[model samples]
Target: MYEASDLKKGIKIELEGEPYIITDFEFSKPGKGQAIYRVRMKNLLTGYSIDKSYRSNDKFQPANVSNLKLQYSYFDGTNYVFMDPETFENYSVNADLMEDKKDYLMENMEVDGTLYNEMVIDVTLPSFVEMKVMRSDPGVKGDTATNATKPATMETGLEIKVPLFVNEGDVIRIDTRTGEYLARVSTK
Candidate 1:
């Protein structure tokens, strides 16, 4: 059990019999009233989010989540498959559950999978991923003067606006959170 005042980002707890992860939290102490906590929580299983407030003394039971380090094996066309490094057991997750993570995941990449009561709830891909550009237009010779960007497709079929200097066949770093291009990675 934990008090509302102890809530922090990444903390998991149960509310209304559903497991949720605290994405952001703020503690507010009213000058003349009671202390309250405002939290933005996302459903661990469904990916839904809501803003809720709790009194300082409100107690909650921490949700039990099993986090495992898994290796991306291969996709079965419909679902992406991952294997537990420890047990060598494989698990397949639906594409909808993977959402934005699909852009960053490559063959043999390592990712973290969250399980609620042993049921896979979510998968977190790396913050930054290296992917090769599969398609892009030619850059203008003097386009480097301004902060211009051109759309490029990565090997995973994800399109992102990369700098004008980028070209097809170039390996670039991508920011997974915003699905933006970071920079070109040196082949050397």
Candidate 2:
């Protein structure tokens, strides 16, 4: 259980039998009223967000959430599969839950899997990943005079802008959060 005073960003709590992670939190003491806690939370199961307020005396149940290190297995036509490296247990997550993240997934990649009530709820990839450019247009001479970029398709099929010097077959580091090219990595 958690007191309203314990509410803060990143804290997980249970409400109405569902788990929620606090995304934002603020405290206020009205001129004539008791202290209130304003919280914005995201439902772990549904990915829905809500804003609610509570008094300092309010209490909340702690959410049951766990993190596991899993390795990317393969994507069946319908679902993405992950495996626990130690136990060799397999878990499947729906495509809808992957969304844009599907673009960054690579076979054998290690990621953090968030579990709620023993069910996989979410997966977190590494902050950066290196991928080979499958296709890219050659940069024109003198294009380097300014900060120029060209579109490159990664082996995963994710398209990103790379510096003018980048070419097809080159490996590049990408920032997963922003979907931006970080730097070119030598294949050697």
Candidate 3:
């Protein structure tokens, strides 16, 4: 349980049977009355944001959210399946929640899965991943301008800018957060 004074950004709480994370928080005390807490929260399941206010005596229940290390199994037409490596329990997350993160998913890759009320709500990829360049154009011989980058397609079907020196069939490191090329790993 949490009191109004305990509200802060990043805190998760339950309201009306739904879990929400506090994205913003503000506290104010009137000259004569009690203090009020203003907060903006984002729904853990639907990715929706809402604002609400509470008085000093208000209390809230903590959200039942847990993050588990799960292995990516496969995605059927409707859901993305993940499995607990130790227990072998399977979790199915809806496609809408996956969004663009699906591009970074690889078979047997480990990811952080957020579960709320015993249901999977979100999936997160690692910070960096190694991928192969599936296609790229030849770089011009004398075009060595500073910060020059060329377009390259990765085997995962994600297109990103790579240094001009990168060529097809090369394995390279990529930053998952920004979808940018980091460095070359090896040439095929």
Candidate 4:
């Protein structure tokens, strides 16, 4: 249990049987009336945002949330498996929760995973990942135009644009957030 005055950004609480994390918060007093707590929160289960105002007497239930550093194991069709490096325990996340993130995950890579009420909810991958270009067409001769790029297929099946100079069997760094090419890391 927490009092309204205790609310702060990054705090997790339960509302209507769902867990929410406060993304922004502010405390205000009207000089005469009671204090109010304003908060902007995101629903952990549905990824929705909402705003609410609470009176000084309002109380809240603290949500049970935990984070772990887990290593990628494999996708088991219905769920993505991750292993606790120190304990050797496995946690499975629903495949739907991994949608776009699967492209950036590599075998045995370490990632931060968030669990709410013991249910896996969120995963954070590295900012940059090194991926191998499995196949890419040769750059056109004399096509020296600035910022020129060609299509490429990565080992994970993520299609991205790489500099014309890049070719098959080359390892490149990718910015996971934007899914953009950073630079060629190596050539095989």
Candidate 5:
């Protein structure tokens, strides 16, 4: 159990019998009123977000989530499959659960998944991933005059804006969170 006064960002709690992860929180004490907390939270299962306020003394049950390191095995159209390295157990999660991170998934790559009551809620991919550039136009000579960027397609079928120097067949480092190009991995 946790008091509203102790609420902080990233803290998970139960509200109305549903699990919500704190996305943002603010502590306020109005001039004429008692201390209160304004919080923004996202539903772990559905990804819906809402804002609510709580009085300082209000209490709520803290949600406990477990994380496991799993490997990307395959995807069967509707659901993506993952394997637990330790127990060799398999879990199939919906595409919505993976969201934009699906583009970064690679076979045998290590991924982190959050579980609540043995159900997977979220998946976290590495900060940076190596991907092959599948398509891009030729860069104009002397294009270094500006920091201009062009769109490039990756092997995973995700398109990202990269510098003009990028070309097809080049492997690059990509920041999965922002879906941006980090740097060219190699020229060849």
Candidate 6:
């Protein structure tokens, strides 16, 4: 259980039997009213967000959430499959649930799966990933007049802008959180 005073960003709590993670929190004590906690939370199961307010005396149940280390197995047309490295148990998540995350998933890649009530709700990838550029146009000579960039397709099929000097068959580091190019690693 958690008191209103305990509510803060990243704290998980149970509401109506559903798990929610606080994404934003603000406490306000007006000149004459009771202290109120304004919070914005995301539903772990549905990927929905809501804003709520509570008084200082309110209490909430703690959500049952756990993180499991799983490895990406494969994507079956309609769903993405993951397997527990140790137990070899398979978990399939709907493709809709993965959204843009599917762009960064790589076979055999290890990731953290967030479970709510023993059911997988979300997956977290590494902050940075190394990917090979599958296609990129050659940069024109003297194009270094500024910080120029060109579109490159990654092996995963994710398209991103890379510096002008980047070419096809090059390996580069990418920041997964922002889907941005970091630096060139090697040329193949």
TM-score top scorer: 4
Q: Estimate the lDDT of model 1.
A: 0.87
- Model 4: per-residue lDDT, tens digit, 34-53? 88899999999999999999
Task: Name the runs in model 2 displaced over 4 angstroms.
Answer: 27-35
lDDT of 3 by residue, 84-141 (tens): 9989999998988877788878899999999998899888999999999999998888
Residues 79-174 of candidate 5 have per-residue lDDT tens digits of: 999999999998898888776788888899899989887777788998889989999998877777567998888887888898998889999998
lDDT (C-alpha, whole model) for all candidates = 0.87, 0.93, 0.92, 0.92, 0.88, 0.92
Clashing pairs in 3: none
Residue-level error in angstroms, candidate 6, position 144? 2.4
Off by over 4 Å in 1: 1-10, 22-41, 49-60, 142-144
Off by over 4 Å in 3: none
Clashes of each: 0, 0, 0, 0, 0, 0
Residue 168, candidate 4: Cα error in Å is: 0.6
For 1-188, candidate 6 gives per-residue lDDT tens digits of 79999999999999999999999999999999899999999998887999999998899998999899999999999889999999999999888878879999999999999988767789999999999999998988887667788899999999999998888899999999999999999988
lDDT (tens digit, per residue) of candidate 2 on 44-75: 99889999999998999999998999999999
Clashing residue pairs, candidate 4? none
Q: Report RMSD (Å) for each prediction in the order shown.
A: 3.6, 2.1, 1.6, 1.0, 2.9, 2.3
Worst 10 residues of 2 by lDDT: 141-150
**Candidate 2 positional error at 168, Å:** 1.8
Error of 2 at 55 (Å): 3.4
Error of 3 at 174 (Å): 1.0
Residue 90 lDDT in candidate 4: 91
> Could you give the candidate ranking by TM-score, starting with the highest?
4, 3, 2, 6, 5, 1
Q: How accurate is candidate 2 locally (lDDT)?
A: 0.93
Clashing pairs in 6: none
